[model samples]
Target: MDPENAASPPAGITREDLFERVWTTPINHLAEKLGMNHYQFARICEALNVPRPPAGYWQKKAVGKEAPRPELPAALPGDHARWSKGTRLLAPLPKRVYRRVERKAADRPQRPARHPMLIGVDESFRKTRTDEKNEFLRPYKYLLPDIVASADHLSTALDIANEIYNALDLKGHRVMFAPADQEMRRRHVDEQEVPRKDRKYGRYQTGSIWSPRRPTVTYVGSIPVGLVLTEMTERVTMRYLDGSYVREDSKLVRSARPWQLTHSWTTEQDLPCGRFRFVAYCPLANIEWSASWQETDAAGLKSLVPSIVARLHGSEAELQALIDAEEKAAAKRRKEWAEAQERYRRQEDRRAVEQALSHSKKQLAEIMEQWAAATAVERFFVEAEKRLEHLGEDRREHIQSRLALARAMLGEQDPLSYLADWLAPDERYQTRYPDH
Candidate 1:
């Protein structure tokens, strides 16, 4: 049967029809034809129990090598069963949620002098400027990988950042700046590794934390995970003196006189903690998800990299669910905006006709009132002239002069002129709509 004639299937696409289309075209390109993003389209395939071409399947097929195509499974009772472009359920097929797969940690004969993400990073993080109050590094370059630290911890921060980036590379997770073509988001990786809510905000905001123009992310298959390695903040007592803040226990504050202490006050603030933390988060703007591991007593943050990667390696299903829900909500929002625009347009069209009709009625009543007033004035003048005939010549002459002034005040009244300028409802507003 023609796919367009499929009665129960959405968008007139049957299960077999969708299966052929996915295999025939790369899923990414196929998404545009169906008016859905790649993830949304992938989800639809999953719902219909359709098997798709694996990554490199098309590449291999292009080289004339046989690429295996999996058979579509028999429909399950809960399956979406069929789909077409019009279907609301776009499939985000994260076909397999990551399972922890262990492999030999290949020892590089020599690790590259540095991972590309870390090249020139040390010089780039110079404390060219800083907030004296917190002593935070305000690097001139904000477009570095999301590694935030201080001058003293720069070397240690690089080592941990290099290790995680390279290790993920060896494990087949491509860690780097997010691809421009992908829709990705970065969580504000604060200087402190603490929960974002608990992290204190201040005038300097712990001094401008470095952020990359694009997020630093890794793709495990089609899933993109964001990474941030930052030094956590420590709470300490700060003393405000004549002009600046200094550590309460510092030499300057400790050397203060009794009189000086009387004017000074101390308050607790978050300074750069010597410790570091690694955070992994879902980088979709519509999704809120993250996991973090900071320096522990027994281990440094470097040792925690593998566990962080492993956790991301396993949380695929959870992130996929969040992404799918967001896609559906976005579609709903677009639909609502379009409906609101149409409704408003209809209301404006109807309002224009009503306003014109109301204005015409008001003008008609005004003209009739003016004509009555003009008749009254004309009769008064006529009656005064006849009464003057009965008075003496001297009295008539004086009264006639006053009547001339009154006529000037109400001069040139004509109902014909008002009628000529009058507009009917049809003339006032010529509607484009069909007549009722």
Candidate 2:
């Protein structure tokens, strides 16, 4: 009988039939069968308010198990709703009650404080030299590389601040900037002063030069560059340091590489008190060593203390000797550990090989037993065929069916592979035998 006409469809041909047919058939074949282009078929489904097939659905179905059909609800009598309402109203209150309880715990007190070091970076200065007329000077036109180089110096200062911030973990700390002098402030401020219109210089008015307009400067309170550095420093410090909080006594140090601190300006004549311009004093001894920024600034006038000092002072030779001893001890321990691991690995390999051999033996025995049983049945069939040489053709077919059933009982015949041919060959026999 034709499978299509085996039974009447429960419902009329609708979107569901289209979905099943479209889903079961390959897209190219389905499109050709419907006499429509692949894209047009998809559009038709959309017009019919049906969702299009998901990408790779065909490929997935080729490898996946058939999706289970949903169970339908049983038919109910007309009076079922009334009976349900009465039964539900008479039912006892549910005993399963969920209760949540709140518990109060005592808060712990703070412990003794630990010392953490405090570090700070000074405000950076930007110097731009202008022409005699006070107009903005272009560095390339004037061959004044120093002006461009000054920007690099500011960048170095910022980098130093970042390194300090990252090393110390000062994520949320505030960085305050105080300009060295009023001249520096005027140069940095965005807004310039303008003269007021009302004032005029006169001999009758005590001969003071006055302007009507007053100088006004605009102030924008943005988070300062130094504050950003401090916040980053706090973050880094918290990440590496122990305890919930940090204190000022933790050793703080900074070092400047490639630049030396010196006096930017000096007084022409010696006097009782003379102003000195402090700069980074980087001597050869300070190279590659971490020191404080504050110390570097003060190194010109005084001998600055070393930043990274151990608890005990020792000669370079003694320190090297200690390091060598520790390294030798570590090497010896590592050698011993390696030997232990090698022995353990060898033992595991032996055990694995033994287990594999045992499993393979068991599997070979089972296979041999099955082969022997199959050979015996084939011999029996040969003997039965010899004895039934005079049997009718119908009797031969019945005997053949019995033999097929016997082979199936012995787990020899695969129905899906041999009879239905529904499953792909690779899927059916990919793992016929287990790995040894």
Candidate 3:
């Protein structure tokens, strides 16, 4: 047998061993030993089924010094050179690429905190005519509308006042309304306590018109807090003489006795008969009228009062219902939005897992391609060594030098030692390819 061909202990090697040895050495150092660029050596390491370490890892190890040449293992038989798809390897990755992947993974949304509450309020009203007639025998009318109209106006005003009150109350403040007239003030006093009254008695006024000697009655109405007062007045002129043609001045006749009815009195003054005043007194809180009340004027005022109250109640109820419905809708939308956010968070977690798996697979494929190419070059070195052993001593030295040159060109270490280096043990390689 040829001495060069003589069998040494066949290198005890497995694919896992080859992968670990090749993977453990830093790529830059391996490149220096093979007289190749770092990237070129990286391709060789990849062919040997080694995964790349991050670039920073090698750079730190080099510490600004020239990278050292890596040692190769002893040669093994061709049979020991088997490669498998599942072979594990360590490969060096570019620092930029690794950082980019890490950043992408971290760019997801985080959970959110709670927010504050939102609220709103609004008001509305309508007008209507009253049934009573005025002193001129014409239908009694409001400057705008009648009792229902006043009630509608009052209801709208109260609604607005209530909204302001609610807002102030939330902020620890108070609100109150005083009436424009006595009837409204009376109503207000009846609704609230004496201490709760916004204004003093006799501060507001109520007025009515009627035919002389006609029976009249007035109704005392209730008032609410926060009422704003405004003034109103009317005047009329009566002409008893005519001056159309002759410009004549007419004289009025004077009666010898202008008879006026008077109530009788005995030893002590007696009360007026069949004529009485109806006064509504509230002990809880007193209400003052700007104008005095007469017994003959009561009937007309009393007749209009109930309509005003009814209109106010209806309008208020409707407005309150509208506000309630709006609030309910707003609350419902908030709840739904919260649920949607939770679902979105869960979806993001699932996507992260899938992305990680895909990234790992892509990295593995790149390492495998590099390792396959390096293996082919190593086999060529093994063949050349066999042919070199057959030459004469002088020619053998020449051939050996040529073989050395060839190894350098192929970026290989000693063929025998390189094979042994490819079969070293590595824990990381074993873990990634446990089944192998």
Q: What is the C-alpha lDDT of each candidate?
A: 0.74, 0.32, 0.33
Clashes of 2: 35
lDDT comparison, 1 vs 3, better candidate: 1
Error of 1 at 410 (Å): 9.5
Q: List the residue pairs that clash in candidate 1.
A: 42-91, 42-93, 43-91, 43-92, 43-93, 44-90, 44-91, 185-283
What C-alpha lDDT does candidate 3 achieve relative to the native structure?
A: 0.33
TM-scores of the candidates in the order shown:
0.58, 0.24, 0.24
> Which run of 10 residues does model 3 get worst, by summed lDDT?
114-123
lDDT of candidate 3 over 279-376, digit per residue (tens): 22221123222221122344532333343233433343444454456567767878888999866755664555445556555555554555566667
lDDT of 3 at 347: 63
Best prediction by TM-score:
1
Order of all candidates by TM-score, from best down to worst? Answer: 1, 2, 3
Assess the local accuracy of residue 40 in candidate 1 as a C-alpha lDDT between 0 and 100: 79
In model 3, the Cα lDDT at residue 48 comes to 41
For model 1, the local distance difference test gives 0.74
Prediction 1 TM-score vs. true: 0.58
In candidate 1, which residue ranges exceed 4 Å CA deviation?
1-113, 131-134, 179-184, 193-206, 238-265, 370-417, 426-436
Per-residue lDDT tens digits of candidate 1, residues 47-77? 6778888778877898988477788888642
Q: Report residue 144 deviation for candidate 1 (angstroms).
A: 0.8
lDDT of 3 at 317: 42
